[model samples]
Target chain A: MTFLPPITAYTCVCAVGRGRDALRAALTGMVGGLTRFDDPVGVLDTFVGRVDGLDAVELPANLTDYDCRNNRLAELTLRQDGFEDRVRAVRDRYGAARIGVVLGTSTSGIASGEDAFLAWSGEGPLQSDFVFEHSQDLYSLSDFVRRRLALGGPSYTISAACASSTKTFIDGAQLIAAGLCDAVVVGGVDTLCETSLRGFNALQLLSPVPCRPNDADRQGISIGEAGGFALLERDEGGSGTALRMIGYGESSDAHHMSSPHPEGLGARLAMTEALEMSGLRGGQIDYVNMHGTGSHLNDRVEDRAIADVLGPAVKCSSTKGWMGHTLGAAGAVEAAIVLTALEAQIAPGNLNLKRPDPEARCRPLMETVPAELRHAMTNNFGFGGNNCCLVFSRDDAR
Target chain B: MRLRVAGISVIGSGMVDWGQAQRILRGAESWDADALTVPTPTILSANERRRVSKLVRLALGAAEAACDSAGLARGAMDCVFTSALGDGAVTQAVMSALRQPGRAVSPTHFHNSVHNAMAGYWSIGSQNHQASTSLAGGQGSFGAALLKAALSLSQSGRPVLLVAADHPFQPPLSGTRPTDGAFAVGAVLTPDVEGAAGPLLDIEGGVNGPASETDTKALHGLWQTCPAARAIPLLEALLNPKTVVLEAGTGYFLSATVSP
Candidate 1:
C-alpha cells in the first residue's frame, strides 16, 4: 500500500494538560493527573483522570441541541492549538464538501441519555427538551464535529470500544484513497460519566490509586477522559518535520468478549502486520507506545507480545500512568504522545513505576532520556478483543 | 467504485431469510408483521449461546446466512458492522441499573453495552481474526456501511462482509428514540466478479440526490421506523436491477447502479 498523507496538525486535551507543551511538561516531570473519585454516581474507591471545567462549557446558540459532556470536551480541544483555524484553512483550500469528518467514540453523549432516564417519572415519556438525534445517538460526535468545523463531506463515527480512535486513521486514509475526500479530520472524544465509571467498577478493573503500568505490584486502571484530533491530507512535499502515518494493522482476537487472548496472539499479529506494511525491520523501530492499562493480564500479555514482535532491545513505555486509561480516547491520545516524543527526540519513562515486574520481558524506560527516532509504533487494544497497531514516521526518514 | 455482490441476507418481522424475502419482493409471498424470532447460532458454543444478546443473535444470524449463501469462508473476509442505536435493550438495562440506590451495574450488561458487541461475538463464533469495524451514522447507517465496504474492498482487494442491524428501545427511553422493531441485513461484497452470484453494483459517493422511497406499505413502514430498513430500495434493486440513491450523510447521497 502507498502512503496516503501526512498528519499536518494535531492537538489533544486530557488530565495531563491541554496542548502539546503542557503535556510535554507533565511527561518530563513524571507527574500524574489522577485525583480521587468525587462524582456523585457510584460508591467505588478509585481514582480518575478527569478533565477540568466542563460544567461551565456552553455551546453555540445554533448548536444548543448538541450540548453534552462529550461535545463540550470536543469543543474545548478544538479551541486549543489553533485546530479549528487549521481545519477552516483546509476547508477553504478543498471546499467544505471535499473535507471528510471521521471520529471514534465508544459512548457518544450517552451521559445525556442517562440524565433523561433519571428525569423520567416512570410514566408517559422522556422530557420534551431531550433530543436523541443530537445527543445520545452514536453518530452525534461526528455530526457535531462536522457541523462545528463546517465540513460537508462524508461523515461517520466508529464505536469499537477502546480501539475506536486508532481505527479512525485507517478509515480517514481509506476515504481519501477512494477519492471521496481530499482531506479528513480524524480524532476521538470520550467524557467521564456514571455508566463507564460504574461499569468498570463492576468489572473489577478500577484501581484505588493512580495506575502504575509495568510495576511489580500494579493494581489496575485509572479511567480518564480526553479529546484529540489530527488533520490528514496528501503530502505536497513541504515540511520536513511532518509526521506521516506509514502503516496500520487491525485484528480481532476471536477468543473472548472481555478478556484478551492469554498468549496475545491477536496483539502479535497486529504488530507484525503493521511492521510488514511499513516495510521496517523490528531492529529499526526506535520506540513502542504500549496499550498497557496497568491491568495484570493486559501488561503481562502485552510485554510478551512486544518482546516477541519488536524484540526486547527496543525501549518502550505506557503513558497511561500519566493520564490514566482514557478508554476510547486512549488511541488518539497515545498517538499524540508518540508524535511529541518523536519531535522532542526523547523517550518518556513509566510515571508510577517503583520496581519493574520480574516476569516482564520487554525493556521499559525508567527515566526520560534523549534519543533520535525515525519511526515509532503505538498499540491500542479494546474490549471484545479488538486490537489496532499504527506506525508513524518522520518525512525525512524516507 | 464498482463491485459485485456475492451474497445477501435479511431478517426482520415475517422476512425470515434472503430466499423468502426475494419471493416476497417479487410479489409471490405476503409480508407478515409478526414479531421476529431469532434462532441460536450454530457456530457458537452452548455456553456462549446462552450469554449472547438478542441483538447479537440478529446480527450473527444474518451474517452467517450471507456467508453460507455465498459459499465464502467467513473467517477470511474483513467485516464492517453498522447500527444507528446499538443494543437498545442492553443500554436500557445498564442505565436502569445505574439509577438504582446502590448504583451497581451488572458486569454482563456492562460488557455487552459496547457498540461492537455483536462484532465481537461474530469474530469469536466465526474465528475471524481479520480486521472488523463497527460504525454508526444515525439514520444513514446503511449507506455509510456500504460506502465503507466499497472503500475497504478497493483498498484490500479482498471480499468484505457488511452488516447493518438495529433493535427498538423500550418505552420512556423509546420516547426520545423510537424504533419499531428489530431489523438486520448482511451482504458479502467483492471487488472481483470471478465467483459473484449476485448483481453488479456501481457505487459512487458525494452525489447530490434525494433518497429513494419504497412503494410497498410494509417496507415503507419499516423504512420510516427502523434505520436499517433504509436498505429496502437497494434490496429492491437487487431483485430488479436499476439505479438507486440513498442518503449517506447530511449533505450527500450514495448512488448505486445495479446490473444483471
Candidate 2:
C-alpha cells in the first residue's frame, strides 16, 4: 500500500545558504558559523546559527496589506538564490497541473502582526505600514509562496508545530501517489519573531546559553528561523538528483497539549510505523536526527522513545545547536542536513554540549564522526502531541 | 488510485445545540433520524473537556457521527483533522501573553494552540491509536483533509475518519466573516469491499483553473452552505450519479462513479 512517490530534488535556505549550490557548500562546512544577536532574554545569550544581513526592506506597495515578519522572511528567503526559477522550470516540465506545493510552519506571521498592532495604536495609521499586516497572518507565507511560484496545483500548509515540515514530506508523497500530481514541493519556512521568542521566554523555556541537545545541563531551545524546500516526484528515473522518501509515519498523543506523553506514546507510534513502511527493522537505520530541542521534557521523552524502539545502538544526534530550533523549518532544514551528512560521509557535531544527560535512556552523539551510512531517520514531534518521523535512504544503493 | 466512499456524517451546529445529531441519508433514503440515540454523553468528561478546545469538541462530535454511520467504534477509526485558522482564539491569547513579556503562557492554551491540537484531542477522546494527521490548506482545508483521509484509507487497511473544522474568528481578527460560524464535518472511508453497491470514487487532478460551471454543479450537489464544507460536496457527489468530478479549486480534486 505504498501511496507516495519517490522524492526528486531537495534544497533548503537557512543560516547556511539560499540554493542547492550554497547548501552543498554549507554541507561541506565551507559556510562558517552564522552571526549572533545580542539577547536581553537571560537564558540564551546569543543565537549560534542565523542567516546574516537580512534587513527589513520596504514591502512591495501592492503587497503591503498585511502584518507579519514571518511572512516577510518567507518571501525574502524564497526570493533568494533564484529558487523560483528552479521551481518554475521543474513545474513547467512536469506540467503545472501535475505539480503541487506543501509547506509546514507555525506562527506564520504573528510577529509582524503583533508589532504592527502595537505601532498602529501608538504611532497612528499614517505611521503604521500595511506590510506589517501581511506578516502576522499564518497563511501569508504559504499564500505568498504559492502565488509567487504561480503554482496552480494543490497547495497545502501544514502547522503541526515542530513536526510541521516533516509532515510536509509525507503529504507531498501522498499527493503524488494519489495521482493528484506528478511532482510536489514540500518544506517549511519560519522566521524568528518576538512572538515565539517572548512566548518561549514567558514559558521560561528560552535558555540564555546556546541550546545543548542531549546534554546533561541542557537548558532550552534557541528559536532560530529558516525556510526549506524539496521537490518530490513519483519516479526516481529520468529525474535530476533526488532522495527517496522511503517511508514515513505520523501519530498524535492526545496527551497534554504542550507537553509530550510521558512515555512518548505518539513518538513511538510514528517511529514504528515509519520503520514498518520501509520494510526495514528498527536496527536497520544507521543515523537518526533526534527532535532534541534541548528542553527539559522534550529531550528526555524523545530519548526514552528512541531507546525503546530503535535501541541504543542507533547513532542519533540533535542538530539544533547548529541552527537553533527553527520550529516549522526544523524538519526540512534538518532533513537537508541529514542529506548533506550522507553526501559528506561525516556527521555534524552537536555544539554546546558539556555532558550527556545522566537520565538519558539512549546514547547520544557528542562529536562529529564519519559514517558511511545508507539509511537515516529524522523525528519531529510538535506541540499537542503531533508526531512525524521520516526515513531517508540514498538513491544509488537503496 | 480508486477508493470507495464507504460512509460519511455531518453534524450541523443545529445538532450541537439540541444535543442530538440529525442524520441526512442522501439519495433514495433521506431519513432525518435522531443521531443514533446513545446513552453516553456526546461531550467529553468535564476534566477532559476543559483540556480540549472548542474546535476539538466540534471535530469529536462529527467523528462520533461518522464512526456510527460506518458501524465502527471510536477506537477502530484512524483520524485526520483539518482547519484553516486552527483555534485563532487560542493563538491570539498566546500572542497577547507574549506581548506582555515575563507572563506565564497558560500551559493549556499553549498546548491547544498547535495546528494538530484538535486532532490530538480527537485521538485521545476516541482512544484510537491509529495514525492521526492534522493538515492545513487555507480555504481548501476540507479538500486537503479528505484527500489525506482517502489516502490513509488506501494505505492502512482500516476505516479512516476525516474531521474538518474551523471556529468563528475571535476578537481582533473578526474583520472577515467567511461563513462566520464554527462547523465540523466528518466522513468515514474504507477499502472497497467485494460486491459493494455504493459509489466508487477516485480523486484525481491537481490544483488548476478557477471553479468551472461543471465544478460548481458538482459542488452544488455536494452541500448547501459552508463553502469550506468539503464533506457535504463529497457526500453529494457520491450520491449524485451524473456528476463524476469535483475539482476543489487548485487544492485537490475528487471523482465519483456509482457502480452496482
Candidate 3:
C-alpha cells in the first residue's frame, strides 16, 4: 500500500446502466435503478437490480461453453468505457504471460449449475457440454476472463462472499507490487441466481421493496447483479484522475458467521488501516462511499464506523439504491461509482433516504453535489466478517 | 519471486506431518495410502467446529500442524489458502435445494458454500486478524497459492502460513468429475533464510527454466491425485540435494533452488 499502483482505466455494467456515462448521469440525477421482479429463483416479494439484454447476448463462438449469466454480465461490462482496448494496449506492453488475472465472486456460475441439476433430474446425468469443472468451480470466472484476454500470468478467483470483488483490488495491487505480474486485470461479475436469492430470503434479509439505505425505517436488502473491471498498473503513464488504487486494508471479525460485529469493530479496523496505509488523515478525505447494505445491523454498524473515521462533516453516500445490493459485485460496482463521482468532482447522494437512522451518528448526502475531491474511500464488508476498505486519490495527490 | 521457506507440514493418506513428509521426500520411506484424518479443531469451540464444513476441517488441521512445526503462532501468521474444489457437500445440498420448488437454501449452507469458508472459519477459530484470503486456480491452485504466499511473506516481512486442500465432489457431480479423495499441504514461509534448519528454496527464473525433478516416481501420484498435491513434488525436491522447478503458471515455470 505504500507505493500504490494506478487503476488507469475501469468499466462497469450494472442495473443502473452499461457505462461510466450512464452511472454518472444516474448518480447526478438522483435516479434509482432497482425495479420490481417476480422471483426468477423462487417465491419472494422483492426488488432486484437484474441487468437487461443478457439473454439475447451470445458468448464468442469459441467460448460457447463458458456462457452463463455471470459471464454474460462480465462480457457486457468488459466492452464498456473502452475497457477491452485498455486491456489490449496493456497486453501489447506486457506480454500476455506477464499480466495476471484475479477476480471475486460468490455464486459464480451456480445459475448454470442449477440449470444442470434441473436437467439431471429430467434427463439423468448432465450433458458433456455442461462442463461442471468450468461452470461450478469458483475459479471459472477467472479462468474464463484469462482465456478471453489470452493472459498466461497468475490467475485465480477469490470467493469470499460479498467482499470478493473489493478484495480483488487488493490482490491486483499486491501482485503488481510483488512483481508477480507487471499489470493485473482485476474485478468481478455476479448475476442473479436461485441460491443467493432464496438463501437471503430464507435468512429473511431481503427487503420486499427497493432498498433505502441509511433510512431510519430501512427494512432489508434488494438483491442485484452487475460486473466491474479495472486494470491496475505499476508503470507511470496514466494521467491524473485516472483512478489509482492508493491504499487497501482488510480484516475478519472472527465474531459472526453471517452478521456484522455489533460495534463494527472489524469495519473500523479496516477503515482505520486503509487511511493509515494511505498516509493521509481522515480529515483529508473529501467523500466516503459506505457499504450501507440497508439491512438492520449493516447500515447502523457501517454508519458508526464511517463517523469514527471521517467524523460528522465528511460527505458520504451509499449507491446501493442506484445498483441494489450487488452482493459480491458491490465492491467493484461501488468503486466504479466513486470513480465516476471523482471524475466529475461530485459525490453521489444516498437514494431513498427520507429519514436518518436514529441510532446512527453519520448521515449520507441526500443528493449529488459538485465538490472538491482529493481523496475518497469505499468500504465493503462480506459474510464471515470479511471487511475491506480501499482508498483512492486524485492523480495530482501523487 | 522466490519463497524462502523455514518449515513445512503436510497431511494426506500418505504423509501425516512434515517429519514424515521429509522422510518420504528423502526417499527413506514410501507413500502408501494417504490416511489423512482432519481432526475437529481444538482451537475452535465445540459449536463452531460442528458449524464448519468438512473442507474447513482439512485446512484447519493442516494449518495448525504447519504453524506448530514452524513455532509460529497462528495469530501472528497471515494466510493464503487455496483449493481446487471447495466444500462439495454444501454445494450439493445447495444445488439439490435449488432443484426443488422454492429453492429454500439453508442460511448456514449458503454462507458456508463460499470458497473462503475455510479461511473464514480459520480466522474465527485462530483469532488471526491479519490479512487472510482464499482462492482457487483449478489444478494449479497450489502453485498459485505458493507464489502468492512467498511474495507476501517477502513483502510484509512476516511469516505466512500457506495451505491448500481439496476433497472430491459428491453424488452425480462426482460421477462425472471425481477427485482422488481428500488431501492438504501447508508451508510456513519465513523471510529469514540465513538461519533455518529446514530446506530453503529460491524461485529463480520463468517459463522452461532450471529446476529439479523428483527421481522417485511413486511421489508423482500427487500430481494426478490432489490439485494441491502438485506442491508435494516441489516439496520433495526441496529435501533432495538438487534444485527443483514447478510450473507456476501456464507456460511459465518457477525455477527454484534448494539449500544444502
Candidate 4:
C-alpha cells in the first residue's frame, strides 16, 4: 500500500456543534447532541441527531437547482472552521483543476424526493420543479461540492452504506498516486430523511432512546445526520508535527447484506491489512475509534474483531452516542473525532457505554482519559458487509 | 494508466450478452427492441436468489459473465460497482409506503434500497472477501468506475472487476428521472498484460469532455437514455480493436486505446 499524504485541513458539522472546537468540547466534556424525534414527517418514536437551521438555508442563485437538505448541510459544513477559505488557498496553490473532490453519501437529497412524492396528488406529472440530477442522485453531493468550491478535477461519490466516507481516504490517495490530482477533498454528508428514519424503524434497528454503545442494556442505534470533510495532499516535506494517514485497508464479508459476519472475518482482515501496510504491530496502536453503532450484532462482532487483531489491551470507544449513527457520514465524522483525540493526546471513552458486555474481550473505555497516543486506528463497517480500517499517526510521535 | 482488459460483458434490452452484443454491433444480427429480461444469478443460493431485485440480477449476470470470460475466479479480484441511479424501483416503493397513513416500509425493501445493495449481494454470492467499493458519478458512473478500477489495479498490482448498471425508475420518478431502458456492463481489468484474454487498454482522461457518439445506429438511442448504455461504443471497440473515447457524463471522459 502507498503511504497516504497528510490531512492538511479538516472540519465537521453535526448535531453537537460545528467546527473542531465544538467537536473537541463534545469529546472532552462527554456531551451528546441527540434530541427527541419531533419532526412532522418522522412518525417513529425515537431520537435523532438533527442539525439545526437547515430550513432557512439558501443556495447561491447560480446553484439554485442544487438546493436540498443534504446540500444545505454540505454548504453549512463547508463554511465552518474556515474550511472554504482553506480550500480556496489550496486551490490557489494547486489550481482548481488540480484538486479533486470525493464525497460519501447514502441518502443524498432523497428527502427532496420524498417531499416531491408527498406533494403529488397521485395524478399527472409529479411536480416539474423536482430536479433529480441536482438533488437525489448519489453524485449530487460531490457535484454540488465541486461546483460550490469551483473545482474542475475528477470527482465522484462513494455510497457503501456506513463505510462510505472512510473509503474516500483510500480513493483520494489513489487518485493522487495515479496523477489524477494534487489534492483531494475527501469527506461525507448525510441528512435526516424520512426514508432512513422509517427504514431503520422497519428493520427494528432504531433505539427509541439515545444510543448506548457496548452497554449491557444497549438497545440499538439513534439515527443522525452529519457532514464532515478533509483536504488531503502529498507530504512535500512539511512540518514533522503534521497529522498523516499512515495506512488504510478495505474488505467485504461476503456473508450478509445488512448483518455483519458472525466471526468478524472481514473486520479482522481490514485491521490486519492496515497494520501490515503501516509496518506497525497491533500493540503499537495506542487507541482505536470503533464502529460501535450500539446494535447488538455490530458491537459484538466488532469487539471480537478488535480482540482478534488489536488484542484486548487497546483502549476503544464509540462517539456515536455524541452524534447518533450518522450512517454515510459516520466514517468521516468519527475520523475528525479521532484526529481531535490524537491532537489532544486524550482518548475519548464510549459516550453511552455503561456496563460493557461481559462477552466482549476488548476493553471499552468508560471515561475520557489523557494518554500518550502515537498511532490511532478508526474502523467503519457498513451494510453489504463492507469494512474499512484507517490508521493515522502524528509524525512527531513516529 | 495502462491495464489489460482480461474479460468483458454487457447486458441490456437487445444486447443480452457480449457475444450477442458483438453480432448486433457488427450488423450480423438485428437489434431487438423487446423488453429486457434480467437473468437469475445462479452464483447465489436459492434463499438469496429469492431476495434479489431485478437490478441485482442484471448486475450479477453481467459480472458472472465477465468472470467466466476471463476464466477468473469470482473470489479472486477486488470489485468496483458503480451506478447512476441504483435500485430506484426500491426507492419508489419505500417512498410510496412512507406516504400512506402508517409508513410501513418493508424490511426487505429498506435493506435492498441501499446504493451498495448489489455490492453486498455480490460479496455474499461470490463469497469473495476482497475489497469492494460502490460509487456513483451520476451519468459519468461508468468512466468513474473504470478509472477507479484502473487505479486499484495499479496500486495493488492485481486484477479488478468493474461493474456499472442502472435500472429504470417507475411512474412519477420516471417523469423526471426517465431511463429508457435498463443496462449493465462488466469488465475484469489486470495490471499484467501477459496471457490476457481481452485487449490491452491505455486508459486516461478525467471529468469534463464532450460526449462520444455510438457509430452503430441500429441500437437506436438507448445510449442517450441509459447511463450504462454509454459503454456500448467502448464494448464495440473492444471486440473490433480500435481507439475510442467515451463521454461518461458532461463532466467526465474515458479515452481508451485498445491493442489486441
Candidate 5:
C-alpha cells in the first residue's frame, strides 16, 4: 500500500540558518557552517556546526521545569517560520484532540542533566527544582511540543540515533493512515551536548576539519545541532502541485551497534523499500540526498547503495557539509533541505570536495545546477544499524 | 483492528520467566518483583554479549521469550521496541565522563547509548532483515508502541513483535522513577486468523488513558514503575479466562475480547 502524506507546512533551525531561506542559500552558495569547535568537554580540538545564540534563546517562564539548552533550541526552531502557529492552525483545522505530535531527539535534555550532575559532585545534593520531566529523558521533546501546542492527541518520540527524526515521518504517516490522528506534527531536535561530543570523539568519527563529503581526503564528520518540524496530513483534494511526502522505508542492519555493514545491505533494503512504496523506479528519481557524513565507511557504503538503487545517473549530494551532522535532527532538517532544493529546482553540490572517492558509484555534484527536480530522496542511517529513506516529490509533477 | 496473541512474555522483579509472570497476572501465582533477574543473552556471540548493557538484555531477553512462547522463530516477524526511560545508568556514566578534562569515554558505552541499541542487537541475534523501530512516548510509551505495531501488523503480511522495556534511572536519577524492578514486556501479535486458539483480542483504537473506573492499586503501581506493565491490562484479560477491555490514552483504546 502507498503511504502518502503531504507536508502542509514545515520549518527548521540549524547551524546553517533558521529557516528554508537560510538553508537554501547555504546550499546554493556551497557555504560550509563548520568552524573550529571548542570542545565543551575539553577533550579534543575539532570543528563543529554549533548553533549560535543558544544562550540568548529564552525559555518561557511557564516552561522553566523543562528549561534546558536542547529544549530551548527546540523552542527556537518551533518559533521559526511560525511553526508553532502552523501547528496551532493544524490543531484548529482539525480540533486539538485530532492532532498528534511526534518528535525525534538523541540528546533531549542530557546537557542540562549533565550540569545538574556536575553540581551534585561539587555540592551535596541536586537542587530541589531538578526534575526529569524535561531534563535528561527522551520523552521531554515530545512532551514539550504537546504542551506547547495544547494538542490532546497521540504523541511520541523516536530516538534511532541519526535516523531518529526521519523515522518520525514514517510513524506520523502510520498514525494518520490508521485513522488515529487527522494531522501529525513531526519534528526533530538535538542540541550540542557534552555526551554527544565526547562520545563521537571516542568513536573517532569527529573530523578535525570541516567535513568534506566523499572528498578523497575527507577525514570525518563535524557534528551540529538542529531542530525542524513538518506538518503531515492526508491529501484530501488539491491541485497536485504542492510538495508532499510520497513514501518512506525503515530498516535495520542488525549488523552492528555503531558501525554500518560494509556491504550496505541495510541501506539497499531501505532505499529499495522506499522506492517500491513510492511506486517509482530508480530511473524516476531526479535527485538523491546521500547521508554523506564525510567518513570513510559511511560514504563508501552509502554510495554503493545509491549506485545500486538510483544508479550512477541520479544527482546526489550531502548537505551535511553545509550544516554538519545533526544526529537525531539530521533526518528532518535534511528532508526540509530536499524540499527546498526541489522548490528551487537546484541540486546543491557536495561542498569541500577536492576530489571524489574513486569507490563511489553516484556522481557527486560539486556545483549548484538547475535541473528538472521532481522526485527527490534522502537517506539517514543511525547507530544500532537503523536506516530510513524518504521520497518527496512536487505535486506539479503529477 | 485486533491481533491474535500467539506468544507473550513479561520479565521483572517477581517472576522467573514469562510463564510465571503470566501465572501471577492470572492470579494463580504470587507476585514478586525482586525475583526478576536479567540473565546474559546466550543467543549472541560472547563478544557481542560482553558489549551489551542491562537494558539490551531486558529487551532481547523478552523478545526471545515471547517468540519462543509463541513457537515462532524470533525473526519470523518485524519488531518495535519502546522505552519511556532509556537506560539511565548509561546516560549517567556518559554524563559523568563528559564533565572531566580527559573525558575518556568507553567505546562500548558510547555505542550502547543509542535508544535503538537493543533493536540492533536483537536484529543481529535473530539475523532478521525486517524493519525495526525504537520509540519513546513520554508517559504513555507502551500505548504508543502498540498503536505503531498495530500499524505494522496491518501493513505487513507477517506478524509483528512489540516489546516495551523500562528501567529506573540510576541513583539520584532513580529517585523519581520509583520503579524498583526493571522490566520488559513482550507480545507477538499476528493478524487475527481462523482457528487461532480460544482466547483472542480485538484492540479497538480511540480511547483516552486508563479507564477511570477501577483496578487493583498494585497493578497501577506496576504500570507506574514498569511501563511494560501497561500491557497488564491486556495480560489481565489473557491471564483471566474472561474477556476484558484495555484502554489506551490519547482517546485510543485497545478492546481485547476473548474468543468464546
Candidate 6:
C-alpha cells in the first residue's frame, strides 16, 4: 500500500526577510533584535522578534462584528500576501474538497478580550467597542478563519496551551492519510495580551532578561508573539513549498497540571513513537529543535532525554533566543525554522546561551552549523502534560 | 481505512437518575445510567469526593463502566476523553476567585480546567500509558471525539476507548449549558474487529446536512441536558435492530450507522 509522500516545506522567519526572501535572510544571519525590556511579563523586553511594519489596521465597518486585534492580525497572515490566491491555485490543481484547514492557538483573541474588559471598566457596556464577541466565544479563531478563508471542509481550532499549533500537523496528517483530505493548511498564530502577561507574572516564570535556553544561569522564559501557518498536501504539487509531516507522536503524562514529569516520561515516549512512525531510528536524526522554553525543569528534562535517546552527537538548539517563545505558535514557527534550515543548509544558532549546562548531555548548537540535511524533528509539550513530537525530513536527501 | 466499533457503553446522570441501573446489563428491558440513585453512593475518592463536580465524576464513573462492559482493563486501552466545559466546577471556581483579589486559585481547580482532565484522570486511574487524546468542539464535540477515536484506532493497532462527558453548568453559568444533566459516552473500538452479531456499521457521507423537521425529532432523541446525551441516540439505535441511522450533528448530512 502506498502512503502519502512527504510534503516539502516553504517557510519564513524573524531573521529571514518576510516570505521566501526574509526566510532566506534568516538562514544567512540577517537578523538580531532589541533584547532588553523593563516589564515583568517579558512583553516589553528588548529582544521581541516582532515582524516589522506589520501593523494592525482598522478593518472595514462590516467586519467589525468580528472585532478582535488577534483576528485582525490573523487576516494579515491568512489573507494578505496573496496567500488565498496561492491556495486557490492549489485548489485549481488538487480540487477544493481535497483541502482542509486546522489551526492551533492557546488564547484566541484573549488580548482583545482583555482590552474589552478594560474598556468596560472605563466606558459602560454600551459604550465599549464590540469586544465581547472575542472574549468569551470559544470559536473565535476558527469562526474567523473559516469565514475569512471560506474554507468549508472540517475546520477546527486546537487549544492545548503552547503545543496547540504543532499538534495541528498531527491532525492534518491523519486526515490526509485517512483519505479525508488530499491537502491541509495547518499552523498557529497568537498575539500578546495583558491576560497572558499577568498570568505568567502570577506564575512567577517571566524572565526580565533575554531567555537563555540551556544556560546554567538562565532566567525564566521570555514571552514572544507570532502567527505562522503552512499549507500541507499529500502530493508535492501545491502552493508555497511541499513538506510532508512524515511522523508525529502524541501522549499524555497525567502526571502534573502545569509541570512536566520530572522524568520526561511523556516526552521520551513521544520522541520514540515519532521516530518509530517515521521508520527511522535515533541515529538517523541530523538535528532536533528542542522545546527549550528556557524553564529550568523543562530544559533539564529535555536535555537529559535527548542525550539518553538520540545521544550527544545530534545537534540541538533553542531558537527561542531569536524569537521569544511564541507559545501556541511556537510549533509552526519552529517548523518554519526547521524547513528553512533544511532548504538553506544552515541551522540557526540558539540565541542567548552563554554557557551550556554541563549536565545537559545533548549538544546545543551555538552557531549556524552547515550540514547535509537528512531528517529533523520538533517537539512540543503543553500545560496538561500533553506532549507531541513531529519529524520532518528532506524529500530528496533521504 | 475500515475500522470497527467492537464494544461500547454509556453512563450518565440521566441513566442514573432514571433509577434503572440494570439497563446497563447485557439484557435488560431498560437501563438508564442517567437516573437518580436511591442511596446515592459516592463514586469518588474520599479526599476529592466532596469537591467532585457531577461532570468529572460521571466522566470517570462512566468510563469505568465502559471498561467493565467491554471486559478490558483500563490499563490496556488507548483512550480519548472530551468535554465542552471541562470541570465546569473549576471554571466557576476560578471565575469567582478572580472576582476577589488575593484569593489563590486552588492548584487542583486550575489543573481540572483543561478540557481533557477526564482523560488525564483516566490515564492515572486506568494506568493506560497508550495514546490518549482530548477534544472539545462545542455542540459538535461528540462527532469530533468519534472522528478522533476512529482515527486513532485506524492509525495504530491499539483498541481505543472514548469517553465524552459534560454536566450542566451551575447558576449564571447555567445560561451557557446545552444539556441539563451530566452525561458520558464510552466506546471500545478495535481495528477490523467484527461484532459477534454483525459487522459494525461504519458511518460515512453527508454529516453536515441542513437541519430539518425530521432531523429535529431524530436529534431530540439524542439530545439531553448533559454531555453523556451523545451516547443515547447511538445506544438507542444500536439496541434496536430496526434503527437505521444515527445523526451525529444538527446538519442532516452527517450520520453514523451500525449494521451487518
Model 6: runs farther than 4 Å from truth? A1-64, A80-82, A112-137, A238-242, B11-13, B17-54, B86-89, B92-109, B170-181, B194-199, B205-208, B211-231, B241-253
Please give the range of 10 consecutive residues that has the lowest summed lDDT in model 5 chain A: A233-242
Q: List candidate 4 segments past 4 Å from native.
A: A39-43, A236-241, B206-208, B248-250
Segments in model 2 whose C-alpha atoms lie over 4 Å from true places? A1-6, A16-50, A56-68, A79-83, A120-138, A237-242, B13-45, B98-104, B176-179, B195-200, B206-227, B235-253, B256-260
- Model 1 misplaced regions, further than 4 Å: A39-42, A236-241, B193-196
Query: Which residue runs of candidate 5 sit more than 4 Å off their true CA positions?
Result: A122-124, A236-241, B194-198, B211-220, B241-260
- Write down the DockQ of candidate 3: 0.60
Q: Is candidate 1 or 6 superior in lDDT?
A: 1
Q: C-alpha displacement of A150 in model 6, angstroms? A: 1.5
Better of 1 and 3 by lDDT: 1
Summing lDDT over every window of 10 consecutive residues in candidate 4 chain B, give the lowest-scoring window: B245-254
Question: Candidate order by TM-score, highest to lowest?
Answer: 1, 4, 5, 3, 2, 6
Error of 1 at A307 (Å): 0.5
What stretches of model 3 exceed 4 Å from their correct place? A40-42, A122-124, A238-241, B26-30, B34-36, B193-197, B209-216, B248-251
* Candidates 2 and 5 compared by TM-score, better number: 5
- DockQ score of candidate 6? 0.24
Query: What would the per-residue lDDT of candidate 2 be over residues A1-398, giving only the tens digit for each residue?
Result: 68546655566767666655676555444333445656544433545457654567444566556435555556666665565666777776877667777888887776665554444343224133434224544456666667667676777677778888888888788777767777777888887765566556656787767788889998887888888877787676465554577898888777666778888898999999999999888888888989999899999999998998998878888878767899988998888877777666666556666698898977777676878777889999887677889998876643
- Say which prediction, candidate 1 or candidate 2, comes out ahead on DockQ: 1
> Clash pairs of candidate 3?
B13-B34, B13-B35, B14-B34, B207-B253, B212-B243, B212-B244
Residue A356 displacement in candidate 6 (angstroms): 0.6
Q: Which candidate number maximizes lDDT?
A: 4
Please, what is the whole-model Cα lDDT of each candidate in the order they appear? 0.87, 0.68, 0.80, 0.88, 0.80, 0.64
